[model samples]
Target: MIERWLPAAASAHACALDAVLFGIHWHMLLIFTAWLALLVVILIKFRQGANPEPRPTEARRLWPAIAIGCVVIGDAVILTTLALPAWSARIAPPPANVTPIEVRVTGEQFAWNIHYPGPDRVFGRIDNSLISASNPVGIDRDDAAARDDIGLLNILTLPVGRTIVIQLASRDVVHSFTLHEMRVKQDAMPGMTTRTWFTPTRTGDWEIACSQLCGLGHYRMRGELHVVTAAGWDQWMKDEQVRLTR
Candidate 1:
């Protein structure tokens, strides 16, 4: 299996990449052998003594046709076999049975504001006038939805095998949410919400980084994504809710 070839804590994206790279490597091997054989044949057969009388053969005419046909067929097969699965897993609509946990990720001038919906499953409304260091995201703490909000600078945790829907937006400049293991990367534009989803298959602590440059702190814009078992995640969520309530 493709996953077996990748790291034990590999995400869905990593698995897709592994599948694609495996196919590409196999293609490269075939191409290398074919080209090398062709070169050797040409060298021996086209030499001065080998073919003194250069005959115009129909081989050249069929070569181009054959190459084109092969290209088209190969592309179709590769796209269908390797690339489609990856794209579907990341971009396709979620299954009817899966209930995704929503996480609002807002990119600011220097830091990331990760707002979890607590136990309400709803994000709090934001008011521009209340925006300040103490209330970074302008979250209306009075709103019941925001009362239990656990805002973290960079740490992100998710339950393994559950689809997580991330609503991404930038508060100031452009930013990107990229997790190498998860293979989920999308740009967060100011005043706009970008959605990306991923189901973590492995349990581990992974890096959360901004792949796009927003400002001077771009290099330091780092976070951690903790993927844990369902029971572990439930315990964490319960603890978070209890702490927020206090």
Candidate 2:
């Protein structure tokens, strides 16, 4: 219910993440109401016409202090029950029984470089010197492994129902790779690779944005995320193969 106004939850783990969001909002609402009620009671009991003098310290009620303690405990409970477990699962490896599709995503100043391993499932060598306006991912075409690798700028396509593992890095400064529909966000730092994985449960198109302010053009740093059905994925693979053979 908390996510109805937000983007479509297109990933398998999206619902779980939404549950955490719901819990937090409801918790805050209860907190606000409790504090407001307490304030009203204090105002009525200590009104100017009734008694202008302040109450003695020993006569003070413990209920107010107890209420504050309860709020703190509730927050800790929420962290243990919802946030921490979801985070642990997010960092967990893909199922060992199934082979996950792997992609290397490099974040530049104003764009995302998507590199796919193609049929071989092995990423090719990348050279920083080869990076340019045309070759954002810096794929070494001379390398046999790189010959079949498919690279694109600001476009990510994945087959629905498959687990995807993405290794992320930055070409320059720090950038955040964010997919709102998938409820996935991770920072890409230069010289160090970060990893994240997700399973697409629905077929649709979504926008990928850089959640961090990296530079002057940060507002325009965006990408396209596409999830396709099985037949559509087959057709895409065939088209890519035909284009690669040429």
Candidate 3:
């Protein structure tokens, strides 16, 4: 029943995230129900009709302590068993044999700048002074490695079944890169670089939203994520290369 409230999980990490969310929701529901029931009982017991005269009541010291202790234990159990392990696994390094498709993402005022290291798979150097209207990421055109570098505006493409490693940064203010389907959210901070990785298990198109309020145009700061099959990704890369060379 609760699954209907969430977006479809499209990445490998989505399952763990969904499980954590469900667990929290269920715990909250249990707590709410217990509190509601206690409130109803207290209201009935202390109603005007039930007790005409006001009397000094003795506090249930042991029960209050027990309730607090139970809450603390519940929180500790959830943190130790669910939250911490999931976070550790998420930040852990990938396996040696797994080759991830690396991409650089730079967030500006109202756009997402995606950089793909062309066929060589090596990111070119960037100069902040060289940033221009046309060159959003300030790619150094004179560098040999930058000859085939591809920069895109508000578009990111990934191949299914392969891990995607994104180096996230911001050019001006802070922005949050959020992908609902993939259950990935990270902050893109200026003067600081953050790394995030996800493996797309399904092929589909989704929106990358900026969760942070950076500027006036923050509402429109969105991008497209195209997850495709391996062959389709290769074809698209070739097509992009042709477009750039021409």
- Among the numbered candidates, top TM-score falls to 2
Q: At residue 193, give the lDDT of candidate 3.
A: 94
User: What TM-score, over all chains together, does every model reach?
Assistant: 0.82, 0.94, 0.92
**Model 1's lDDT to the true fold?**
0.80
Query: Rank by TM-score, descending?
Result: 2, 3, 1
- Tens digits of per-residue lDDT, candidate 2, 44-117, equal 87788887676678358698789989999989988999988888888889889988999999998899999998
How many residue pairs clash (N, CA or C atoms closer than 3 angstroms) in each of the candidate models, in the order given? 0, 0, 0
Model 3 lDDT, residue 98, Cα: 98
Estimate the overall C-alpha local distance difference test score of candidate 3: 0.89
> How do the residues 1-246 of candidate 3 rate in per-residue lDDT, one tens digit apiece?
888888889999898888788878888887788889978987998888978987656354487788778778877887888888889989987667899889999999999999999889999888878777777778897998987788888999999999999999998999999999999999999999999999999999999999999999999999999999999999998998888777
Better of 1 and 2 by lDDT: 2
lDDT tens digits by residue: candidate 1, 1-246: 545655453555566766777787777677678778878987887887967788778356677778667767877787899988867776776677989988988887667778888778888777868777666667788887788776777778899988888999998889998887887789989989999887788899878889898888899888888999999999998998787667
lDDT of each: 0.80, 0.89, 0.89
lDDT of 1 at 52: 78
